[model samples]
Target: MVDTVNDDTELFTIGELARRTGLSVRTIRFWSDSGLVAPADRSTGGYRLYDTGAVARLELVRTLRELGLDLAMVRRVLARQATVRDVAAAHLRALDAEIRMLQVRRAVLRWVVRSGSTTEELRLMNKLARMSAEERQRVIDAFVSEVFEGVDPHAPGAHLAEAMSALPTELPADPGPEQVEAWVELAELVGDEGFRQRTREMAVAGARGGEQQPQGPDPERIAEHAGGAVRDGVAPESAAGGEILGRLIGPELSAEERVELADRLATFTDRRVERYWHLLGVLHGRPPMPPRVPAFEWLIAALRAHARDASAS
Candidate 1:
């Protein structure tokens, strides 16, 4: 019950306010001392007293604190220095960033468990996973810049440099295990000196090919016929393999041309390079494409085999 301070005023002791607001007396006392809910008056025995308005103020303070507002922010809100909506909006953005960070850490842990990563590998994975989107893009950009340095952009396959450097502007706020794994592998792949040299070779060859029209054989035909031959398990030296090669590049080419085609194909093909694209696809949420390098390898072998037979004759 509230005690009457005068005919026109009524105030409650700290215990009475706690009972009314369902808050602890200690909490109320703390806020009162902090000047957030100032006492309206004092009692004869030197006890703190709060008018009815203090009870309402305590409820607002409780709500703000429960919503994760710090004491300074709570004070600001009570002081009308900021509106509740403005404070909430700012808090929401902070919460989003925190949530995204937690998601990335969770994904990294999940990948670590699946891969049984060593201490160094785990450390690397965590570092890469926690990088900001801009930092991640820089990783890819550096790789592309070094590999394609001085290579003509208009070259036949030089466009690949653009695609190679393409990483999503930001990883999904909640990336899955596959994406995390892909990112880690991609980071490692780009950092390899051997891979960089191989990619540069492809870029230089592409620029040379661009100097002439009709860049090598038709990739589609090779993928279809040569890919089919591989699927059918046809040996490259077999007569049956020659038939597929004919369908792939036509029977009009001479032994010299066949060897040239094989050399050209070999220059552009590497399983690790293909794996780079596969990882990119995983990160971009693209459907997994079947490996096409084996098929191309078969075509290269067939070209070499047939050319050799003709030279022997």
Candidate 2:
């Protein structure tokens, strides 16, 4: 049982009600005087008196005050100018936006420290914070449309075009500086002649060679030999390489097949194709895989070595 100085039915003094509600006496007085909350009746001496219901009302008032509502809004709430749920929902959205901005500020500070950034960089970071969700999408959309505009969705090359154009349709209201940098770098990378050529070259090459684009280092042999070479750090052309090669390509398989795989791997092993994938991973919020170029390059040489052995035989 809640110990009340006065029972719910009994008229309690304003001071007693204030103590029960944990509101300061002056605040309770102000609310009563403002016509926001009124005592239930007059006491024996005409002092303000409150009934049990006043305790519940006072609790609601305190809640509104704690939530940063001005008295006017509080009164509006009490009077149903707007429903509490409606006002609360709106405020909740506003708070979410504020929290995102603060997170972005922290990221920008860290980026400034990491890059030894100049004032110009600070300005850029600040500017990035001001971008709305729609604005950010526009930036991504424009870049992607330009890069992949002509690609026919029905064509074999359409997949590459689609990958290049994929962007986050929604960014957090306040995106961090790293997100901003990624956007800028991505825009620059897509525009870069080297990167564009690299993507186009790989796409065109994939079309030219289809699945066999990297032949001698065929899928089965690569996952076996090159994959193992990457794991064991073995040079493809070493004298001991024959053992690894034998395991990968099969001792029964002719050296000519290995050479064919190697030549194909070399054609598509350019770093740009890897970077295109890397950027795509970032857009998709994925962790990255290790580079396999060294392993493939090794496989290419091993393939060539197998050719030499076949020639000598």
All candidates' TM-scores? 0.75, 0.54
RMSD of each: 4.0, 8.9
Error of 2 at 195 (Å): 1.0
Clashing pairs in model 1, backbone N/Cα/C closer than 3 A? none
- Report every candidate's CA lDDT: 0.87, 0.68
Worst lDDT 10-window in candidate 1: 208-217
lDDT of 1 at 157: 76
Name the lDDT of candidate 2.
Answer: 0.68
What is candidate 1's CA lDDT for residue 221? 76
Candidate 1 lDDT by residue in tens digits, 13-97: 9999999999999999999889899998787778888998998899999988987999999999999999999998988887887
lDDT measured at residue 268 in model 2 versus the true structure, 0 to 100? 72
